[model samples]
Target: MGDLKILICVLIFSIKTVHSTKSKPHIVIIIADDLGWNDVGFHGSNQIPTPNMDALAYNGVILNRFYTLPQCTPSRAALLTGQYPMRYGYQGIPILAGENRFLPFQIPTLAKKLKELGYDTHLIGKWHLGQGYRNATPGAHGFDNHFGYWNGFMGYFNHEATGGNMVGLDMHHNDEPVWDTRGQYATDLITEKSEEVIKGHNESKPLFLIVSHLAVHTGKGGVDLEVKDIAENNKKFGYIQDERRRMYAGMTDELDKSVGDTIKALAEKRILDNTIIVFFSDNGAPTIGSALLDNTGSNWPLRGQKFTVFDGGVRTVAMIYSEQLQNKGTINNELIHITDLMPTLYYAAGGDVASLGKIDGINQWLTITKSEKSQRSEALINIDEARNVSALLTDGGRYKLINGSTVFSEVDGDFYGETGRDDSNPEYNTDDILHSSVNILLRGNLTQEKILNLRKQMELKSCRKSTIDHDSCRYNSVCLFDLFEDPCETTNIANKFPEVTERMKSKLEKYWSEVKVQRKGFLDPNANPVYYNNTWYPWLEDTRCHVGDLRTILLS
Candidate 1:
């Protein structure tokens, strides 16, 4: 015990901390659903204007190599638990609506850890982790308050979700069905709710809020895309010819509004200077010709789409904005995975990172704030035995290996997006997209010219086009590439680098062997909302415990 205490002190004082606030730094995580690499303005997309997101990125450490699981559930599981979802087996795929899978209650979540330090934890939208069993809900996982749907995606206005045609109203405030706010756009409601939480927060206790948004994700059924003020959106995005893409632009615009509004609320509460706002997409966009949920967001210049292990799917747009960092307004190309969030934020909130027992995440608090070397080297992109696919990012992200490719890989492997928008790809140069607000929002340390040069220096440099054969790969195939030179993943070097490929394959096998839990989500008739008062509610009995005989004593 004495040794542990001394070690904790050593770790705490080993490097300079971000800030020493009167209160613990407020932690806010803003998630964008199915937002693609090319979807945001910061990522060099001119098709849509994301001035607010760009402004925040310009001010913060723009994450040049942020990696996530190529799907929703696994990525989220990693972030919350600080462990790869594969250990307890939620990594293979997303929980389809009405599926009986949930992250095991035994695993302590990020909210639970923060709660241990007296944080007021709240989840404002999209709790897709679990819903069938009460023990699997957000309340059971440690969030003090949860407001939103339990399904993967829902109608922005109606809030009706569908899982293989099992459709019903999904909006809920805690465990109860909510109906009063029907016909309201989800983006507006989500933004409003987040602002309300910030405004109403006691502030005596540090705030740990997760604004898990539903924006930019395709909504339910045929009316999949919902935007607030479509008439106004059409005029704003009339330049983009595709109707669906135009609607998507409007949805993305709404998402930016959420980001801007949340930051404003934090500033208004006098916590902006002491707040750490983490923003990133849960996964890459499901572009046209992708395997599932074909939303119109683009991952152009990055090969493949959602669910594929290519850079487009796993390598996502991410940034960390905080007034705490001394190193500001530059891109950090360190190897960072979604799982790192747990220890990173927990440490930032003053929790002992050493006490976060047996997690896959590496503590990067000092690295990000001080521009030191990242603690992680290799990252498991994904290992889904169900999909018969797996991938690994190894050699400090210099090499990548993908085995058992999905059928849609060939189709999605091609760089996808409207060519008209690609003329002045933001990667080409930063002449047009820089908003004037960047200088003001950047905490005043960096001049506009210095910030621009930093942006250029850290930008993802485009390589000479490699010929990508669309018809070559079929069904499943093992492919390897040197990711340092090939971020787009156009060439497969598996044969050229046999030794590297085998080593990575061995690493993946070890992780798969460590997995002790696996759950598959399947359609069920009983899960339909008609049986549960026309709303999705818990139906399964709690599987959190087993029956045991009571202890007894007999007197002579």
Candidate 2:
């Protein structure tokens, strides 16, 4: 009788262990706005110290070949839906203030899908996909709670967008404007709210938190593009002589602190070991003098800056940190797109990827964690409607085909609209610094020679060289470059590789045709009238200005 009782007790213990191991892991995605490729310390930036971010990179896997749209709206839209932005007519153009454009409620977002699987969804920070529309709000998109601004950017201290014809308050908590948060800095407020959410998370179910930070981007209503950092923080960068660069560095420091705070909160809650954290920039940095008052962000060692289809404009900083990673402190050079995160995270939460229909994204969790080669070998397409440019990269980023009129241009002192700054040029080569830093961070697990060899393996030989004329290359024109041999895109080789060029052009044509069909059925924001407070008004109209005024029109 005693032996039989002991056998029953052992059987019960084994069953409980198996159930505990099957619990779903928490997901946390942290995104930075307009963060440059060379901005973080892990990427070999001595100007800005990102110790916390550096630690995470060393403890996880770095995605070396991550790609995104050239702008914010398209990137965010693709990330949430796991589909190409062009499918929904959200190309590369940004959604401006007072515009009727927004993510439609009919579309299913990653948040909505995860919430159905019993996860708490929360968003803390910038939500630039939509504003002023009731159905386009974050709560309507499957987020249980949201605390941030709706527009692209606003004053860091005042929380107001006072640029061009866009002058109004933009901060919000859920659906209502948050007026009491006027004096606080936007970055700190986002951090505080994120900590609160992490601490108050329910233990019974997993959590899905998206912390989209508005840092390293210029503030509105300032003569010289301002970055709102505390006065004491400015003193920390006295060694940097350039005032603008110093201010930018201060902003980056605050962002790094926020990352550390979030990780610390997870640890305090005792859920750090069961959480998967992802960090990436929304798009490449805008270094040209066109927008945001001459942004001083850098995309070093690459050609072109933001607002272009060059490699520097689309390739960005990305990484994944988790205790579940099989090969930590390694670099995976697979070609992964921004849209892949949805399917990847969904699969991580024990959801079936095959059940998702018509998604452009693929599940890359296994490839990233195990350092396995990517199953996708076809070319990846990047389109920018605002610039009339398109590019196709084949042979795993070894070759590039550009179809546009824009030429490769480097950013210098004139780009920043400022003089007397030594670090004004945005194309400094930091390969040696990056290799040394990676070796040290990984405790010599990755040798310097191995890093150099990995880069060399990505290069290819050029067959011929041709001079590329800015006017000669238009929307239909084709230009080819062996990216491995000419990373700067100095020579065009379309004449030598006619077969390859024609094949890539045919692929682009087919893709464009398909997207046009998909876009035709999409809702037109300009045609439909928006209903607000029991009144119908033109979609492009800014009704917030006439709120509580006699000029208001009642539809009833």
| Candidate 1 lDDT trough over 10 residues, lowest sum | 547-556
Per-residue C-alpha lDDT of model 1 across residues 380-454, encoded as one tens digit per residue: 888777667778888778888887544355354566655334543233234332432332333445445764676
Q: Where is model 2 poorest over a 10-residue stretch in terms of lDDT? A: 412-421
Best by lDDT: 1
Residue 21 of model 1, lDDT score? 62
Pairs of residues at least 3 apart in sequence or in different chains that clash in candidate 2: 459-484
Number of backbone collisions per candidate, in order? 0, 1
Count backbone clashes in candidate 2.
1
lDDT of candidate 2 over 1-556, digit per residue (tens)? 5564355334333332111557888999999988877676555445676766765665678888888777787788989998877777777567765566788778889999899889999999888887546668788899999998776777788777542443666677886667788888878899999999999998799999999988867776533345555476557777666667778778877888788778767765667667889999987777665553445776665555565566556678888987679988777888888888999999999888887788888899899888887765544455654455677777777777878723233332111112211463332223433333222222224444544443344222232234434343455567887766776566678899999889878877666765532222223333221233212222343544223532334433
Model 1 scores a TM of: 0.89
Computed on alpha carbons, the lDDT of every model, listed in order, comes to 0.78, 0.68
Q: Estimate each model's TM-score.
A: 0.89, 0.80
